[model samples]
Target chain A: MLEKGTTAPDFQLNATPDQKIKLSDFKGKNVILAFYPADWSPVCGDQMALYNEMLKYFSKHDAQMIGISVDSAWCHNAFQQDRKLHFPLLADFEPKGEVSKAYGVYDDEVGESKRALYVIDQEGKIAWSYLSPTAVNPGADGILNALEELEKK
Target chain B: MSTLKPEVSSSDHIEGSDAASITIVEFGDYQCPHCAHAYPIIKEIEQAFGDQIRFVFRHFPLQESHEFAFPAALAAEAAAMQGKFWEMHDALFENQYRLSDDLFEELAETIGLDVEQFQKAILEDAVKQKVEDDFESGVRSGVNGTPSFYVNETKFDGGPDELFEMLKESAE
Candidate 1:
């Protein structure tokens, strides 16, 4: 997985059928990249729902979060609309799991992304990262703590 | 692995013992069905634990999904000013399926809150801010979803059934 202080690799992924988000575009803003296995899984559903409720907190810290998964933009659109997700869920499809692999969080054996989190600083350097057990909904404490540390510096 | 960031404070709407060793804080959305499902179970836990537990409810509305959530939270906070927070809180969860924008005012009346005062309170900044602040605290405390629980300040990563079972086992 990506480590703190590493310059996060840039990528272009689909946010919606017509909208593409570039990692480099968020250079001046802190970004939370949450790479998970798939959409519609029970744990991922809860994790996204939890983050959906937390968009304001992320915004308060001047941070934007984008969820990355192998799910297609169409799938993400349906899931986001159905779940009422406020943030974007980028599709790491096309070349499936490309972004997840760039972040070194791809699970080759499982054919899915490992549940991972990366808090990238304003300069695009990873400020913090964590690898969570697949079934565990690794909540937002780590991400908030990293944001707090960034503000302190 | 996470703990409640700011800890339970005087502003929290609390039920049960002040001297309780087990304090369970729930960050819940009034319109979330999962929260509604856990509602009876929560009441059961309070009954089972009795004076041994302090139950605190904090607002964490997902306004995007549940449009009535934030308004419901506002209603509860407005009721809090009239010392009927729990009464309005119960009315919300009990009628979660029928939640709507107009439901808050009706609930306020049902709970015996001064109807005119309740209507005015929801329009007040302090009442709205209280719910928003609770949401911030919940986010900082690692809350990821409705019905998220923190027991004695530590996040409990389980469902209500698992939570009650843990408490039951620990009390033994």
Candidate 2:
């Protein structure tokens, strides 16, 4: 995975069937890039749902979160609507895992993205990064802590 | 593994012996179906273990996904004002499928709380802050989802049923 202080690689991925979101679009604000394996996991350990609840906290730090997975835009749309998610889940489809690969989070064995988190500062430098075990949900505390640290700079 | 942050304190809703060797802290959402499913299993665990187990519940309501979750947590906190926190907690999960603003009142009356006081308490800013505090603590403690459990201050990597198995084996 990318290390802190590195310039985050920019990419454009599909946020929906017709809408494309670029990493550069969020240049002025802090960005949280979350790469997860898949959606519609069991109800108990839902990583996305946990993040959805923390949107207010994330915004309080002037940060926007984006989720990336190998799933198509249609799949992300269904999952987002079902979970009432307010943020975007970018589809790393078409080329398949291209964005995940750029960040060194793609898993070739499973043909999906690994569970990873990256906090990018306003200047697009990686402020923090974590590669969580596939079975575990890394949660929001790390991201929040990273954002708090950014405020001190 | 993630460990419980801040630790269980006077602010938590607790049950079982104060000096119990095993402590279970659960961060749960009231409107979540998975938590409702774990409710009865938790009851059974408490019954089987008795004094050896200490249980604490903290609200981690996913307000966006579960629309009524925050309100239900508020109702429980309101009931706490009348010394009926567990009663309201159980009632909320037992009747989760029918959770609504009205159901809170009905459950309050059934749990024998003063209806007028209950209504007033739920709207209190302090009560809302209490629930929000619980949520913030949960996030800081690395709670991944509703019904996340911490056993002896360390995160338990599985569901309630798996927790039950571990408890039973420990007692053997």
Question: In model 1, where do residues sit more than 4 Å from their true spots?
Answer: A42-45
Docking class of 1: medium
lDDT tens digits by residue: candidate 1, A1-153: 876798999999999999999999999999999998888865322788788777777888899999999989999999988888889999999898888999999999988888999999999999999999988878888898889999999
Candidates' C-alpha lDDT: 0.89, 0.93
Model 2 alpha-carbon miss at residue A122, Å: 1.9
Query: Which sections of candidate 2 miss by over 4 Å?
Result: none
How much DockQ does model 1 earn? Answer: 0.56
Error of 2 at B126 (Å): 0.8
> How well does candidate 2 score on lDDT at residue A134?
95
User: TM-score for model 1?
Assistant: 0.93
